[model samples]
Target: MGKPVACLAVAIMILFLYYVIDVISHASGNRYKEGDPIPLYANKVAPFHNPSETYPYFDLPFCSPAHVEEKKEALGVVLNGDLLVVAPLKLDFLVDREPESICRKRLTKEEVARFRKAVLKDYFFTMYYDELPIWGFLGKFDAEGIDDSIVTSVYLFKHIHFEILYNKDRIIDVIIQGDLQNALLDVTDNKEVEVDFSYSVKWIQTDIPYEKRLEKYSQSSSLLHNMEAHWFSIINSCVTVLLLTGFLATILMRVLKNDFVNFTHDEEAVDEQEVSGWKNIHGDVFRYPRCKSLLAAAIGTGTQLFTLSIFIFMLALVGVFYQYNRGSLITALVLIYAFTSGIAGYSSASFYHMLEGKNWARNLIFTGSLFSAPLFLTFFFLNTVALAYNSTAALPSGTVVVIFLIWTLLTTPVLVLGGIAGKNSRPEFQAPCRTTNHPRQIPQLPWYRTTLPQMAMAGFFPFSAIYVELYYIFASVWDHKIYNIYSILFIVFIILLIVTAFITVALTYFQLAAEDHEWWWRSFLCGGSTGLFIYGYCWYYYGATSDMSGFLQTTFFFGYMACICYGLFLMLGAVGFRAALIFVRHIYRSIKCE
Candidate 1:
């Protein structure tokens, strides 16, 4: 295909995927409700330590002496600290109804089944598998008798129970299960008073254990969910190990390289040295032939996804798409993330290109979609598996098509357009102002030799800004914490992108000051170092934990390592890109005698 057509094809592929996801969600009528049966987060737990009472201390009305006398029974001493971020929630369709449960204005049987399937499919399955799960309701269960329960062509289920987990003013998890055949089963319950969903009631988490297998015993069948989940499990495991090692190894290697020899060239300064803008500083910042920068873009794209995932999770915490309601929100967050890939690719490639870049195609392809594509495929495959196996909550086909369309028509085009704009927007190079026509002696400082360490350290402060939020995000995803924050997480994501690049530039500058004339490799290293710190901190956090057990837990820990590894690589690319841009500006400026 020609360039335009090729671009169109790429856009179509991306849009097709995105459109599918979105369409599936929207076509489902947004049935999943807020909240689910998931556990309350630690921040909430910190306030509920009162032994005799179940309610948190902050709930005291302070209206009467009875309230004042009970004030001593409160759960916590208020204080200020870093506010954490948490994951976004889908819906919870689990559990039978409880007395005093909120009444539904119009509860239908189909809604119940879909919601139940969603609960099992979304929370239990998604909570377990980052990509997709095998046993989720969509992947495994299918209620064949729901079609008979229709009244106005709307197939409502017979039985429905909405389960919710809460902490005072904040509702944590929610589950809504409705039995259709059963609702139609007894003509008695339906012939009566039309009850509403506003049924006033507080729900509680029971010790009723979650069944290990998705479907109940009696009829043996294919374990599609298990098989599918296992496959991804393997993939996730490998990625985790490699990711962990990648960051850790890179950090150690860079440190060693710095200690041993200078990766930067020692082209002795010549009198009247009329060198290309970046020729004076030989480093990764200048330009990588092809695979190098492309590889960098791929890695950076993954890291950007990882960061964005965390951002989605944070939004989950503050209750945007709590549990059952998560599909729409997750879709939205991902759309935004995909659209932003332009920055990662364009930013990286633009600067490197300016430094006299060779191949632009590789750079754009990797940066634009490499990172999101993998996970996107994972999710799509999971949904496909779910559909094939006739899982209840599997995404609808129309939604899938729509999601795919958006990726093509909306995200891809917009990102590319934005990249074009960014490409046209050049950085003012001022190196000519400082470049001397007469040759000068090059300073050699072993410590200041590589941009790797400097750029890596530059990622520190930005990393710090996000560390706490990330912790909460990971906790929510793996630990089954009730998450519902999105807006804050979205903002944080924007901040992270800017921060990562800014810190990278700062570090690149500092290394230049240290007398390291190399910009090519050091720029990449300086920015990529954040991954090392992030992964290291992740491991440290794991070690500090008191509870660590079972294959799932171990797998989660390992998979996180993979995420970190990929994430580090992605960051490295981005940082390099940013640093390269700056370096090119310097060279160009110097050439122009700016």
Candidate 2:
């Protein structure tokens, strides 16, 4: 007991230390004074379109420059005409006198004519600011007297200022603005079109302190000021789940206790009562599910995802990745998923073996490639479209090759090793109730107790628990808002898990009570149906909340959404199965069987 107490104390101290370190990390080295060169990175260029021509009707062609170069440590991209360049500025308070380089590409007379025609054909410039595209041509362009021979020069302007108060660290604010200046060249046109870039910095000391400045920088915009509402929803959902859990515990536990006591009485009482309901189908409860190999593979893949999600969230909580660190999250996900392939292989093989499944090779292969194949295909298609549009969002060929190598060299080998280990391990599918040679026939269930209704009921609770938080996540992803409340997200994640487990157990009990011995697939689908709700929510979000309008954006949204939904299906299915497995084993073990 003392040893256990000591271990618990040590664990508590370690956790406290971790939190302290996390706070210190955020507070330290975050100061930026005046006269610092702020780093600006370009994302992509897209054509601007009117609201009427946004979605299905929008057919504007956007492109990244054919060539990019760095001169004197300054990056530049060649632009022939008006184009929207997305250069996101970090919230670093600093100013540099050095101007960014922008190379102007001179177009021939014929090329200029083509460019003018393209511009007239609904091709306008736009830029991304605060994650939303600002139409550059809205009121900034002067189109009168513009023709083929007119020279267009683009100007990039960056302004940075510090808001400081006494005894407080200064807060930095940055604004990036661009303007297009056009002039016609005459005979003896010795004047060359030159691109001008300028930056200015200013400091203002006020009563606002550093903490307030940081808060201002990290605070959610008006559009995302639903944090309180989200918390309310979460609390409401938690109360509902708690009530359900209490009801379930009261009814199931009390009834099961009485049943166990009565059934374990004298032999005469036991014979008189006999077995009924769930006990009647005990033999079939643990029977191998049909298509056991497929189920096993899914479970394996889900386990891998579960492990990956935990680590990712922990890393996020620790501030290893942030919204400003572009692509860091994706890179971490890819590497973590690759490294966790072993868990998938091991889980799939072990579960398949437990189910007495043959086709070990097929099961192993399916486990390894089930999730990865669709992910790769979706990414490939999206990247292909991006490349065709010459968008910088497209992954480079070398990066793609590296990902392939990681999958092939590291992921695949680890999976094979894990599969071997799982196969060699002892089979441990022992059930509390002995399964007979013949499977029991499942009885028909009522409408409310049917598979579909139970799944809908089971899934609704978990989805409800997270839908509010889900909206914020969607805003952060699609709207480009910085989500800094990792602690809240982590809490909500825990709540979601609890709700999923409780709801799954309650639903599984009802199915078993209905004499539906075929609970394996039903149990899996019951929880996983949350993904359907999530997909439906996605549809609603696209049509209602999001302002994104383009064929490429639409395709990218739905295409990647499919992968996300599929992953949720696997994850929730595994969660339901594990929970139901434990519940079933507990109930069955308490029964007095002759």
Candidate 3:
């Protein structure tokens, strides 16, 4: 049975690795081929009734007539009644050239109605430039050039510039800029107006290479102002790990050596020595924690998250998610989370059984809902805010229903099956030390040695290890930057695990030494507290580094972050508890108690 289980586990891991590698190898690369149509998506359209409320793509008008194409990727939507062309603009630098209009077309009555509705609703237009989105108004243009005429002229400016700044080699940076100017459309008037559309491209070149230009551009974009800070974070983490390793080594070696000397001595001589410390509480060390049901459920959920996270990083390491693949990351996460529901159910049921809990059905139900309930509620709230604002960020009602169905149809059933299997298959909970019928009275600990302080201390090391990387992640999500360095992210993730494990074990030892046998939850909290620090950092980043403003952005930021922090809490907590459990069992087994 053991061999089969081991083999099964190995097979699953191998399969997962193969799938990730296959995806990275064959997935759509981010490079843009010649003549690929650049899609133009509109921002959220504020409702006419309430100007502040917005909904993303719903009820908005496309540049062309509403029609679904068989090949979706081949089409581009119109923005601000202007058809955006994606062809590269070539300039003749030797001689001055005539201005060329890229797109000029008349709007049909239906298209005109759609454009008018969007204008009244105040929808912003967005254009994509090499995976970067630039947002602007449809009828607004820079004040540099303007002319008054009888016919209303709506100018669509396409500014293309190339710069080569260095002497060694000419590396050019290509920039595609889009902006608009509205002359005839008035918000108060309902009359239809004819508008002339014109576009022009301007190219400028310097000696600097494209790479150097990109480096400068990246510096200005986010809080990653310097590479020194990244190096510093890595160095700090390495130092902390080394210190933790030394501390754990010294303590374990000293305690184990003392235990060996005491165990080898005669029983009479051993008893003659002082009857104090961990040995005194051996009888109650393995006693079942109060509210075992809750702990079991937490552990189960944590285990599932742990498994999911490992696979996610593994996928990321192999570059499964590239900048140009829309929704790939989110889609992967949702599917993986749904599939891993069985792991949560199984682990929870097994742990609950070991704790001698009778209500297996309740245990399973709680295990399934533990993370899912809060997640659903948080997402619902964010969706509500988006709906109220009439923003494009709001998920469609159909999508929401589909997600719910996925959870119900796919996740819940698997959880039930796995829970039943685990309940039946789980072995009895056995400890080297016998548990007492009555709970041991935990002694008073020093002020600095209490749960809160220990949690703060234990959480800091792990949080510090990844906080620097966290900055880049936040920038990519919120600041519209491209993050393609999966290899660096994978290394940071591994370091986070090491830091979490070592710090958790250290804190568990301190707690046990203080005669606190209730290490189960404490161990979990010690590692999970890292999420608290992360939240604190988020607050700091928002106030200091980020320039984001407006109710919609704020609502999305904090709302999604709440779920993220909670998930982190679960993952880190489980890691800490597992490490401490192994250490405690090892120490107890090494000692011979009468």
Q: For each candidate, what is the lDDT?
A: 0.43, 0.62, 0.64
| CA displacement after TM-score superposition, residue 366 of candidate 3 (Å) | 1.3
The sequence of per-residue lDDT tens digits that candidate 1 reaches over residues 292-337 is 6555465446445554565445444543443333244545454656
Ranking by lDDT, best first?
3, 2, 1
Candidate 2 lDDT at 536 equals 87
Off by over 4 Å in 3: 1-125, 128-175, 179-195, 200-225, 259-266, 270-273
Alpha-carbon shift of residue 225 in model 2 (angstroms): 3.6
Clashes of each: 103, 0, 19
List candidate 1 segments past 4 Å from native: 1-319, 322-324, 338-358, 373-456, 459-466, 483-506, 546-553, 564-594
- Which run of 10 residues does model 1 get worst, by summed lDDT? 73-82
Q: Could you tell me which residue pairs clash in candidate 2?
A: none
Best of the two (1, 2) by TM-score: 2
Per-residue lDDT of candidate 2, residues 1-594 (tens digit): 123223433543454455447556654534444554333333333444312122111122222244432212101111111123333233234333333323344434443443344443334333333222233331122233446444343221212222223233444333333332322222112233332222333344466544343454356454347767767876876787678778877987887777677666674645534667777777778887888888898888988888778877877877666434334466567766766777777778888888877788899988988889999999899878766765555655756777789889978987876777677774778788777898777766678888788878888888887887788788766664667778878887777777777788878877777778888888888868888889889999989987766667777788888899889888888888888888888888887544
Give TM per candidate. Answer: 0.43, 0.74, 0.75
On lDDT, the candidate that comes out on top is: 3
Clashes of 2: 0
